[model samples]
Target: MDSVYTDVGQARKAVEQHLARACAWVDMGGVLLVVSELVTNAQRHARGQWQLRVQAERHRVRVEVSDSVPLPPRWRPGKLDGSGGWGLRIAEQCADTLEVLTSARGKTMRAQWLHPGRTGVAVA
Candidate 1:
């Protein structure tokens, strides 16, 4: 459903927990990274609180972070030197489908990744 995360660490734990055994197929490390970026961006760039919503299907998992600010996310070109402004790029690279939706009130950054396997849990 929907949740509000004041802290990035706690939000990550909740996301992993909710995804359950499905994380085995969805690359949990990548998923968590995307979540961290989205949530942190919302907190740092937007006013008021941020909301986290996740939807897990048979083939893919989608994570969305919404905020009150209507400003759109900026995409920075790839670079060898690691620095700021890389969050959007990282999410774009990791996700199967990445989107930024803007409305009159605010915007939502959505990241989706396909599961690695069709089974309940992928074998390691």
Candidate 2:
């Protein structure tokens, strides 16, 4: 599935609806949430439209979001007061592999989570 979100709010709903159909109900929530965060980040920080793709493969499910900026995501420690910058941190913990690829056209953030049989294990 592929979607184009112009803003953060749209991306959230798009992720949830799309992931729910692509992944199992039990794992849909986590995958959707992670995809939402990634898409939201791109929508907020990047210039043009953001693209999202969710696919279910043999042993895992993959979510990829592309933006109009070549810069990769930043993973800085959160502030004490009330600021939050922990999206990438949470995604790293949840996903088996989280990759950020940058090019002149844009940057793509891809997150992969394993299926039940794989138990989130990486294949070598």
Candidate 3:
């Protein structure tokens, strides 16, 4: 699924729905959270409307968030230990593979999570 939304809140809801239908509801929430952070970062830093794409492969669930800014994302210290603000770090922990690519049009952040059956077994 691919979508472009100017509103971050709407984009978040759309991502949640897409993931929920693609996977388990609870698992979707986690994916949605990561998607939300990516989208939020794009909106806050990028100059134009962001784009999102999600794909379900046999081996993994993939998400890509693209923004107009070419600069890469950075990890910064969070305000409080449990008070959020660590989106990139959290995404790195949740996603099996995460990448940031640069292009003339914009930058894209890609993240993927391995499917349990295809990956042999889920890590504890």
Candidate 4:
């Protein structure tokens, strides 16, 4: 599923709906966390339209968030006062593999979670 959203809440809702139809293979909570973090980052930093693409299979689900900012996301030390800077770390921990691709126009943050027994293997 692919969707474009200018609002963070809308992006979260769209991802929730897409995951509802996927098979019970991947960890939904982890995926949702990753999606939320990525989308929230785009909204807070990119400050414009963003696109979300979700691909689910029997053993894995890949979530990609594309925004109009060419700058890649950075990790800053977490603060005790919750003054920001933890989303990337949380997303990385929740996903099996997290990658960032940058272009002149924008960047895409891709997070994928593999089923417990299917790590590093392709699903047939």
lDDT digits (tens) for residues 1-124 of candidate 2:
2334145566657666665666653366677678767866765677546887777766777888887788887788977675768778877777878999899988889988777677757653
What lDDT tens digits, residue by residue, belong to model 4 across residues 16-98? 77777885767778888888888888878887567888888777888999988999987899898978899999999999889
- Please write out the lDDT profile of model 3 over residues 51-119, one tens digit for every residue: 888776556788899877787877687777565568888788778778999988789999888876666
Pick the winner on lDDT between candidates 2 and 4.
4
**What stretches of model 1 exceed 4 Å from their correct place?**
1-5, 77-83, 117-124
- Go through the candidates in order and give each one's C-alpha lDDT: 0.79, 0.72, 0.74, 0.81
How many backbone clashes can be found in candidate 1? 0
Model 1 is weakest, by summed lDDT over 10 consecutive residues, at 115-124
Ten contiguous residues with the weakest lDDT in model 4: 1-10
Q: lDDT per residue, candidate 1, 1-124, as tens digits?
A: 2335248888898889978865557878888999998887777678547889888877878899998788897776657676568888888888877898899989999998876655465322
lDDT of 1: 0.79
Q: What's each prediction's TM-score?
A: 0.80, 0.76, 0.77, 0.86
Instruction: Single out the weakest 10-residue window by summed lDDT for candidate 3.
Output: 1-10
Which residue pairs in candidate 3 have backbone atoms (N, alpha carbon, C) closer than 3 angstroms, thus clashing? none
Clashing pairs in 4: none
**C-alpha lDDT (0 to 100) for residue 78 of candidate 1:** 55
Between which residue pairs do clashes occur in model 1?
Answer: none
Number of clashing residue pairs, candidate 4 = 0
